[model samples]
Target chain A: MKIAVLIAPAVHPVSGRPCAGEADLAALALAQRLSSQVDVWYAGAADDAALADYLARGATHIHTLALAAGREVLSPLAEALQDYALVLCGARAGGGDGSGLLPYQLAEQLGRALLPDVLDLSKSDQQWQALQALPKGVRRTLAAKLPLVASVHARAASAVGWSYARLQQGKIQRKAATGAALPQVVLEPARRARALVAASKVSGHARMQGAIAGGEGKSAGIVVKQGDSVEKAQVVLDYLRQHQLVDF
Target chain B: MDFSTQAIPRIDPRRPWVLGPSGLKRIVLGDDSGSRDAALLAHGPAHKPLRSSGPFSQRLLVVAHAERGQLDDAAREAIAAAAILAGKDGEVLALLYGMQDAAPEALAELAVDRALTVADPGYAPEQKLALLQQLLQQESPHTVLFADRSEDADLGRRLACRARLSVVTDVVEIAADGVRRRQPGAGFSLRERAQVLLLARGVAEAKLPFVGKGERLQTAALPAISEQVQDLGSAASPASQLALEEADLIVSAGNGVSNVPGFLALAEALGAAVGASRVAVDDGRFSRDKQVGATGKTVQASAYIALGISGAVQHLQGIKSCRHVIAVNLDAAAPMIKRADLSIIDDCQSFISAFEALVRRERNLV
Candidate 1:
């Protein structure tokens, strides 16, 4: 019954503090609830200051899979995580070329079953039951065997909030990458991306309303008509002193 | 960006893979477009992996195929976007996975020059990934587009990792040199010259232009791979009683909704279908089928009454086709307020009660 949590870092916009990512922290909380054999692991290099946040949250050991320079991350990280029985990751990351695909790719590489958007995790015997989150408030219970990867959602569990005392107690162990380099790998240039919306005055106008000459206008297309009858004729049901007659 | 109806691109084998005269550089590759012409029909060998012949030019490939046969909405958008980007110089190609028989001829409706249908019926995720890897090795496309799905992202990321290609997921806007996406609250990041771009879950699919060439081809089976996982049937129940996609009137709930019974009652009173926001769905208060958002089903309802929804961008994308919207919630600042024609700021449960009482009184008066 070993559980391992994957860690990614998030930089809060307002505070500029590097915190354990929201989704990852939720996953960590679930891992902590699962067993005492829980370890926090990061795939790439991170500032030690940020890694400290996980130690306080309940992770006893932190393993950093230091990707070799010029090596792709998938092979290296996948190879290193082969031994863990249950691996949990956040649904996505907030910063850096974060595509929210690492967890899925890792599962594919590890040849394990992936249960994504997991809101809760419980085990009985050798089987694991996952309360998975889909769109809306609907939840699905998925059962998978060990050597499984699940992506934890925000609603997974109560996260262990940050504490300075635990941060002082956590220790990090670094592991080197083991992937072999490929021949003739083309180097991709730095991606150039800009905000689609320009800086403008904060106005009361709505985005859907402004685009409305002929296209679907938020206000133009709807008719709110429907089944409209009530059984209020049952005056004896309430038996209340009628405010209109009795008060006088 | 005016394209001339008379401008027909000529293929120059000498100029790499660029389409001449149209000057649009990207080449879209599909599994097989029913192209009988020997040149367009013959792309490369069937079983052998391809090593690209030249430097990269603009090209877009749509990897379309889920467990089922029918193409998904995001896949359609990927094709639509590729068509718009193809213009005259670039080309649109579709890559279909599954067994040889799984590739259908219906792709003629799409605005693509050619499409490649690979024989891969089992619909294994890893097998599809391997086939794509082989095709990519031969073409070296400028940008690879995928329908934003959990598995699609996984496959795309695996390709990116193995190929060392720059990648961006959850993209919305398509630019000349690249694509851009807005980070919530934070401004936006643009990815230029990236090798791969994946559309966010809810990019509005574009309408097709007038005609298509209808060329197609079927390829060999994907490489063998061990399958380890089995998909369990959906969790909880199947979904809501009403199909939100077909419903004309939708009474949607959101996070602010407190009285679940009252909310359902409102929908029943109005004779509208029930819908919920992403958060409401995650709260286990509603069925996944009732969700209306980027990850959920889109509806083109005549009127939508939103209760307690905070109008995240993903949710807004789902309601784009909605005709008239009326929102009720306590916070006037929620994004849904701006999208609604009439917004009432109040507690939603109380509002429903008041409406119920008024409706009964109005019926009596009549």
Candidate 2:
């Protein structure tokens, strides 16, 4: 089965600093874990160098969708995903529109079943079984037919190991793609309300010394060192009180 | 064709039962029931001063799922602290849920003007939200308070949005018309407003106290409704999955814990459940169920060992209630280090390996 991976680059405010999004890395890692026949798609602001790197890693094809600033457009990408059997995206983007609502909105737009926060995915009998993370380390399994959207949460799987051999033989192709019309919402630039008034610096020596003292004090477990039972009990009470363990 | 002419039942818009200002009630929404009850007892009665002060006659609502666990002393202290803050201007009412008989004890311990028990079968998130929403709408409370990490955060957000009110999340300090949030970010500074407020835990204004005693209510006599609703079931599902109140030990990891090499071994060695930070789960390092944070799960283990976590405000809010926090990190400056009972500034991998080795050696010696 062919898989399409969606990626958006992270953008920094003020300095306009550029960084690869953690979500992209997560999606790429998942794509690598699937069968080698998978293809990759890049949406919004991915430079050629990053595209080449993804190609080197095993992406069969890279599709780039050009978007202007402040577009807040997503429907075009959702439309482009129509051809793919299974669409994979990050549960949340790290920077620039990292609302964590994109996947749900996209799924709704596409009218496809969305399995979110999926930890493990396996394919059997033309359907995919997903192990979803519930609260408190409990997991629930869900099954969806092919051509569904899976927005994988960051902790869904281990990072895929990179290999030099795969990098050497991998093919890279770039395709120019058009997205659906940009949504008509006007976005006001984020305004800064406060400025740093003062900054304090602590000497490294003082920090190190403090760390040493803290380490020593912490290593001595169960502060009741006295052999006398009453004294030990008093020490325990003192310890609890010092730590604010009990409410009076 | 004439359907529009059907007379709507005459609803009394200003019925005295609805217009009379309900006593200012405070609810300690927390994961810990025992602590919540203690807090109600400690500070619930003192809130009577608000009636004399005027403009603060709203009631307090404490909502939490009972099946999750009993509130401990620390949670009670937090509630007491909130009660003290709420009492500065209004009458306090306490609502306690969870366990078979928490209502009467809560009613007795708290200076509750009236006690309402939302029985077990009716224990769903939507039901709780709907019931609270109905109460708040009817009472028109000046403020609604909730523990920062409780499942009620979602409810608080929805209520605030629906009611067109501003909510102050993760509040550590609260005063007359002013609130201080706990962390650095947007809306961290003290907000001054007489408008209806929803205060979350960890705000900078008040120090959460730790209590030692909790009241156990009589469950048999409390009013109950048994009709099950599916929406409420989903909302309460997340809280019910946690066994933290009963856990003796918990081993939690964060995004910094990249691989799965040591998790199983640590869980086996410590006989503890494995937990993860929201960042860790978002990075695909673990499942969402393992996540512990504001948007995740709350744990009250006796011993909590944190591995490679920086302890962001959201994550810290959930685990701060744990009895002991043992933090292992390479960075001594990580927030978790400051909060930890035992802070180890060493490689987490080495510590995990050493812990496993020590456990194995001890087992062999036995």
Candidate 3:
């Protein structure tokens, strides 16, 4: 299967230096595991310095789609990924438009099925299987036909160690743009978010109770000072059951 | 006394007495306006009742999934956002996907004017999308609200892409006119209202000041569409293999625990992820990633069991976000015991054995 790993420009969280996102690197690693004919594709604004980081990590054939200054990459990226049987990318971008909607948009544009938050990927008998990550450490296995788009989870797989040799051997080819122009985004300074607390309608006494006890009226902690190990274990079990933490 | 022409002045509650013209004391009895206050005191605040009196001129849609027939906190928040934005003239309609274990009448508490349940089984996103598009065509809601969590996150993005509308995700604050979301870098960007809104958790108060009609709308059968993706149901991964931050339950060991193998066994028995104190990691008893403290990973697990851990300030800081903490320590004076919701004063090894035995016996019985 021919796999395409979508790469996006990323910056270090603290140093703000150009770097690859952890999830995107994970996607690249997962792609390498599935097939050796994996090509790295980058679209949008230029960040060659970060692309170099992907080269250092294990990306062999890197294609940078030449998108005009302010144009969107949906149509161009979709056209670029037309040949690949599978398209894999991080569930979210590291920097630009961190809305995590690019994959969904691409899947819709290409009219392909999208398997998101994939922790692992494999292929067997002409079908792509994905281990999807759900909330609270739950996982769901999903199967889809060829020509599918999957978004790699951040915890999917760790990227291979950086190789200075790989960086020298990797090739980054610039390709012509084939996308439409998008609307200009207006940038403004971010503002502090205010928590939306409803107007209190209770009496002054009830309001005081809320203020003193804090919200959600949970009972205070229990200190079991006297009990044998068996009895204490029973207490723990009872508490766990009361909270529905454990079934048995 | 020409009482018909002149209205009598009401007595203030602060001073419930008035001096008569004859210099006699006249005591004011119960206040006529005190009935509402009495009701408030007896029944706890009365809802302001925001039933949209006028015809539905505009509609605000809230799309959510009810797990086991109960609306999660995030889903409730989305409904509240729609209700707040709908105001009096506009109607708030909720489209629920998945099996509703409870009756639709429960939506009355959420201020939902009308609810349509998509009760079809299976993981058919395409069919659900078709139904959603059909509903969208039938009632062109001004704005569709969705919770930015779990399955709704995927569904909302899919809807936005198919509709070709730019969706504002992780919207922390929403009002009738505008919405705000966190931008790429640091600050928040306030944008004009979009057609689809993916609301973040706690963006609105679920407790409403009004009651809705709670009318359950009848829906046609799901539109048949060939689905490309197949869901094979949930895969079971043992909790011990899960990451600490992602695990719902964690069993942590501290310096007081001498038996490392026993601690690991207890964690496996309890079906929980393993965590360690900084001291335990420093002693090379556990890996660096397993450390949970100020310098280690911060965990937001629902339940955390601290075995033989004397609650160090740094260790407490990491697990502070944990919903429930059970401390098993020799000393009741330990700081962990104070921070723990339930503290059992006992040796870590004995407690582990007893707990494991209890769990095994309970499982066998079941």
Candidate 4:
């Protein structure tokens, strides 16, 4: 069985700088878990080096389906997924396309079962057992036949231990697929009306000073004392309250 | 970006394919209003009972995890209201799980055609899923409506996948043939058609009448189903560090509340449970479980104090069960002020300090 894991590199919203978040790590973890049975394929919008990192972990091959400049399209990637026995993607991309609708749209187009926000998965005799999270920690398990699409949530896969030797020895080769024609949709200009207004007001000297002071206080290091249960509990509660950790 | 020339698969316009079996089965997931105090702050005084506006042409199934203590009367009323709404056109089957004991007669009074009681025997997620899937398969629902949250979304998606049907999430509006999903892009709503419609939100703005003229339904004891899985003796143990349902007084903060950390002291001072708005939860200021909104826990408490919460419709829907509401926000135009019994148009932090001091002074005088 060839399991294709979809990958979308996380990008910084403000700087457009490429990075990785918990979702990428989660995909990598899930791919590693499934590597024992099926040949894992990593298909993503990343450069050769970045793709190699995933390949080193467990992927058999790396396929890069970069979005063309001036186009916000997902057709090329969706079409390429036709060959895989089971296609898995993150529920939502971290940056630019953060709506988490890619898997849904792809499933609709392909006319296949689309499982979004899958939390648990187990395979037996070519059948897949998946657990879904419901409201209030309630979960439901489902069985699906092979050749399905799963959009993994952040909590779907558990954290896997990484090996240094695997990272060093992994060879990542990029194979490009035939790109689909870009959809003809009118692109709207990016809106920054709120940010612009906030920026202008914060540009003043006194305001900047106050912000700097606040930032410093926010980042202050925590001090812990040994064997002080009451004080420790107080610290924890205070931290949670100050940081809005609790419900209130 | 464009659907104009995408060569979208052209289904026969005259003969549209309808998925799922031909059965009048409906799955109704009920949220316990007494589970969290934030529900009272989020939903306010206008306690709109859950009711079905459209024609209910299916086997009605109601599901809820039973609450601790004497079940809140208002919460039971809400569930009863939902049951009545669901039973408007079909037989109502209720599956109440995670309860200390079975109350079948009370459920029957609430118009339950059949009641399945699962004991609070500490079933794991996988175990619960298996049982739920089995139940769903045994009684297939044409429509499934669950609370719009992470767990429900997961279950709904998985169920849809297994049933070979389309699943839409974050649906804020529901109708007969389809649902209106709040799309990602700014304020856009998508109309989706499906055989099995999973509603995250039932018909918006529809008021359901309170059940039984506020009379308490008599409890009917029933034997628990014996389904041996793994040892469930320890499963009922409390997993969360905090139990919001047991809290009488709650102090909830929102986006407008500055110094999020300061609220802890206030909670401690007033002997109140702490809660938060959806904004704070999304901002990583609090856990999603602690969030009080339409998408979060429904809280019913004696006194719900709102700090900087503006009381949006979504937030209001979650906290409508609170008896006494106190809002402290700087925004005079905030909807919370209008809904609150005592609206203080002041900084939340300052209000907290004053309230704490006043409480302290009263205690000292006593």
TM-score of chain B of each: 0.49, 0.44, 0.70, 0.44
lDDT of 2: 0.54
Ranking by lDDT: 3, 1, 2, 4
Query: By DockQ, is 1 or 2 better?
Result: 1
DockQ of each: 0.10, 0.06, 0.51, 0.03
* lDDT (Cα, 0-100) at B245 in candidate 2: 40
Give fnat for candidates 1, 2 and onward, in order: 0.10, 0.01, 0.64, 0.02
- Cα lDDT for residue B139, candidate 2: 62
Cα-based TM-score, every candidate: 0.56, 0.45, 0.81, 0.42
Model 3 chain B: worst 10 consecutive residues (lDDT sum): B33-42
Candidate 4 residues lying further than 4 Å off, grouped into runs, are A1-22, A25-248, B1-57, B66-88, B99-117, B120-140, B162-166, B183-196, B201-203, B210-366
lDDT of 3 by residue, A79-196 (tens): 8899887999999887776789999999998989999999998777878788999876889988999889999998899989999999999888997786777655556566655545
Q: How accurate is candidate 3 locally (lDDT)?
A: 0.81
**Which has the better TM-score: candidate 2, or candidate 4?**
2
Model 4 clashing-pair count: 31
* DockQ of predicted model 3: 0.51
Q: Which ten contiguous residues of candidate 1 chain A have the minimum total lDDT?
A: A239-248
lDDT of 2 by residue, B121-143 (tens): 43243455466666666666565
Interface RMSD of each: 14.0, 13.9, 5.6, 18.1
Ranking by TM-score: 3, 1, 2, 4
Among the numbered candidates, top TM-score falls to 3
**Cα lDDT for residue A22, candidate 4:** 46
